[model samples]
Target: MTQVQTLDRTGTDAVAKAWTHVRGNLRRSAGQRLFDQWLKPVVLVDGSTESAVRLGLPSSFMTQWVKNHYSERLLLEFRAVLPEVVSVTLETLSDEPQRVLKAEVEAPAMVPPPASAERPSFDPRFSFQRFVVDSTNRVAFNAAKAMAMPGVPQFSPLYLHAGTGQGKTHLMHAIGQTFLAANPGATAIYVTGERFMFEFVQALRSRDTHAFKTRLRSVDLLMIDDLQFIGGKDATQEEFFHTVNEFMSAGKRLVIAADRAPQALEGFEPRLAGRLGSGLVADIRPAELELRRAIVARKLEDMPAVDMPAEVVDLLAARITANVRELEGALNRLVAYANLSNETITVDFAVNTLGEVLRSAQRRITIDEIQRAVSSHFELKQLDLISERRAVAIARPRQIAMYLAKRLTTRSLPEIGRKFGGRDHSTVIHAVRRIEDLRAKDVEIDGAVRALMRTLEG
Candidate 1:
């Protein structure tokens, strides 16, 4: 018996034919177990592009599993039947309800949007005109603005580090937007360090690394937020270091933002740290009173109809000194509460709405909590982590625990010593110095210390 062949089609028709062929082949050639476990959840989301087939998986595990066991086989079969397809791209569907809601709300507005026209580039709301540049953040803002100019390499990496809500992300985004506006066709990517690590790992595992390098290298500007998250991932760090080198060699701009300076980042490789520090480093300080007031005014512009008493604004500016996010959150609450209750906004209302968040931010975490968090992360018993057991494994973790406890907590050396199996105050000091020295000399040690600090702080 002879089988009939189907005629080759063009464009969307061709994509549909190719997808059907690939799916039918997988169902027949692969066992029921593999099909159900790995291939069942995969859906053909986009087939408009002739050269690529976009598939959506349910989760990261499924994506990894399919890529590991069946990616090559599936590609081979698909190519044999339809040679036009070049690659398969897998993405996981986001599960968050809020994301779904946000997408639904925004989808209608985005339909038929102009392709070449970008969204009002700089978040017109977040300009230097509105940014509260205090003494602490003034230098960093100026440096960032200078770096954003055309034909300037004032700072190659341009590392911006500070605690949460200290405007690192804001500055980095502003810089990217500024550059793109000034130099048309100057592309930039602003990604969190976690996303960078995720893409690096996925590319490495799938062996489509050339594509990865091209995606990162082809951009004229790269801005990474929360650089600390990638500190301990060796493979990601290696890939990122190469990307940094390529960008720097080409005189392309690189901007990195983290919660702490490169010298203070624990688990980051020394070589990576050295490269980061080679350029200008700016530390954004905590928001001052005037800066806080400016932030409030900027936020109020969003709700122009809502009236806030001047005294209430002053009280909030004076009281909420932690970060910009917190300050704005407080203002949001105050506005919401006042609007709902139909009451005049006052100092008393502001106090009531913002009391808990402010107090919590001011609440100091104790040394014991830091010790416990560090111990739990390393899988050592809390007692073992705090004990002076001089075993290489236990000692290193113990010393790191001590160092974090001292730095993150407000406890004195002697007080921290008492908590750590009653060691002498000098012993506590010694442990801190030892960890610091090791961190400075050894990249591996630095990575561990950084990992421990993140756990403790969290």
Candidate 2:
């Protein structure tokens, strides 16, 4: 009995020492940025045995991400340090036991299961019911819903483009979920660009490329998010081009999303870009002020217990205009800290708790900056904007500059007029009204304004 006790202690010490060595290996191999974001949070859970090791992450999402990307690497690292270490499992760091994401006994065979196997499940929170529609994303939302409905796809590859944290992934997940619900036996898969590349590389190393192709081609619906990550990967691009062709030929639903339009994707093959843009291409603009306010109110409605003041709501909606994720994160932080401290959810309390976030959110753009951005975008000289020329080329750009100045800056109408070659305040008003009306009817003008606003705000 004493011998067994000593052996157990020795094993525990060995595992602890092995974990330290493994962490160093991971940091050096994964690089600094990837390590800090995903791997740094992993902790060796208590009660791990010699043959079975447990790793914990803060959230299920992080756990899944780490599992998908680093699980095999982690297991190999542990075994190299301590040969007895047989497995490394990932789970959320909660009191309740999470679904254990088990690494394979060896490396995963890049081969996927048969077509009859269960389809991948999407996040329940990202259903169509949860998505909020507005003028900015209504077209994309409607297209997603239409694709998910039963019958033939109206468009082969529905392309969704937007900035980060904007609703691309959400809509993709919603489409997968709704489609699967409507067609219970249908198969669907959602993979990030990075994950697809990782799997493809693994298959190449294993000499099992056929299995990978079959797995993807057999799916009824395929949605790939963040296609920008696979940039410059020549082999992956070749495989992706073929995959796109297969989907189009089969009339299967193929959805892709990226930070920019297909034509704007750098290092991508021209043929691939042209094929991707051959179908319906929809862009989700940044949420306007009204939509942001509505989002805040919608979030508040979910938390009935938290008595957030109207002033606080307005403050959050108006200030945090970067993305919906950041906006919602600020609100969550305020609510969580207030709950922990048993403090009243007042405007003053919110201001104090979210000082750094609010400070970063306050980006004060000037009229001069707007004029320069607009002039540069329109290929007009700065002098042309302030000149008396009324040509369509010059006058239209000037009106756009005035409209942006009004929307992005806090200057009064008279102040804006004084800066624009001493025009009357009425001219500025007409420009604002005319641009506003044009945005509703003219896609090109709206796209230009959205692009200018994003550039100037940054």
Candidate 3:
């Protein structure tokens, strides 16, 4: 009878209270990074019965992640809190069934009518002011700014390429915002390759492609992102080639971004690749340790309450070498967990709190990877680096390879030297020193080294 009275209490209230307690327990036990990333967003759905519990997540991917990792744990936690709870079910907060995550799919694209006065809003957080710039992305940053200027840009088709989360999209958004501000009456349109193909197909189906072409070409500044996705779409490529011609011929500004250089795009026509590369092709290199630290500091400025220590900052920057997004994510996770647990931010706290994340971010780059990247960059055979050639053409690339090996790998100098033709530790040291000095004084060498590092690290 007492248990019946307990069950008589509104199921919503009882379940909500139990959910809150279970979440707190999970947070404390699962560690901050994993809890916040996967379980924090979970909500108790309204379909719970006396024996079964339903939990809702925003998407299928998250549902799957949590279900795979914490289903049994969740069931145990709920049953511990409420003896009547017999089962836990995780589901997406949607009517649709779970779908497999796949590559970017083409869909009907929406371009604002040329006659429409309304403008698309740019993400306020991604403005140029928020961008952290250094040697790695300075050229692309400057070129993006130049494209946004009032008059015709110095470069007609500014092509920007970088690995994911490397600020290519940030630069594109900044360009759109700046261009609109500089020319109040001008029109700017941003679309991804998938969207471009989608809109084109929609136009084809509706037999209204003239409007599509007009809407796209009539814009004053047109920016395309994820251009790699459009490869092998011939009909879409034909229209795109014309769009590029229209902009170039009309002197309108065009900016494009992809994950790789134009020359490396697979299944792309040579002419389209050439057209995209005809203008200034700038690459956003991977963030160096200094730049990464600066980014962490800049991010912290936004969270004034989170007083992260300097060593923790250094450890994060050094360990999370993957990309800017992960680096910032690590910092945010650390700050959030510390706040939740009321723990002071320290190097040890960061390490323990972000153990899983720190390990995953530490991608071990090998000397073989570095050598391959350098050899490809210098157009030398892979063995040429480890061979006995002393020609400046081969020797300089070999030195660069040795320098990269020492800097990028955990291997000792002797191990690195051994990889590079069994040279002595002194030889490896000299190469490292020479490259370091050249990186300071010689722009070309510095640029080459930066490119190589970006390739390897990215």
| Predicted structure with the largest lDDT when compared to the true one | 2
Model 2 alpha-carbon drift over 4 Å, by segment: 1-113, 365-458
User: Which numbered prediction scores highest in TM-score against the true structure?
Assistant: 2
Model 1 per-residue lDDT tens digits across residues 1-458 = 11112223344565555556565545433323335567866665533356776666768888787776566555655565567767876767556331111112222332332222221223333455566776779899998898889996776888999999888877876787688888896666666788688766766776767756765677777888898998778888898888888878888889999999888888888898888988889999777555677788878887889888776776676556667788888888888888898988976677677778756655455777776776777788888866658898788888888887765554678898888888899988899889879988999888777666444434
**TM-score head-to-head 1 vs 3, winner:** 3
Clashes of 3: 0
Q: Which residue pairs show collisions in model 1?
A: 266-446, 266-450, 267-446, 267-447, 267-450
Error of 2 at 126 (Å): 1.0
lDDT of 2: 0.81
Looking at candidate 2, the ten consecutive residues that score lowest on lDDT are 1-10
**Candidate 3: where are CA atoms >4 Å away?**
1-118, 364-458
Using all chains and alpha carbons, the TM-scores for the candidates as numbered come to 0.55, 0.63, 0.60
Over 4 Å off, model 1: 1-124, 363-458
lDDT (0-100) at residue 275 of candidate 1? 89
Q: What's the best-to-worst order under TM-score?
A: 2, 3, 1
- Model 2 vs. true fold: TM: 0.63
Candidate 3 to native Cα RMSD, angstroms: 13.9
**How far is each candidate from the true structure, as Cα RMSD in Å?**
18.6, 11.8, 13.9
Higher-scoring candidate on lDDT, 1 or 2: 2
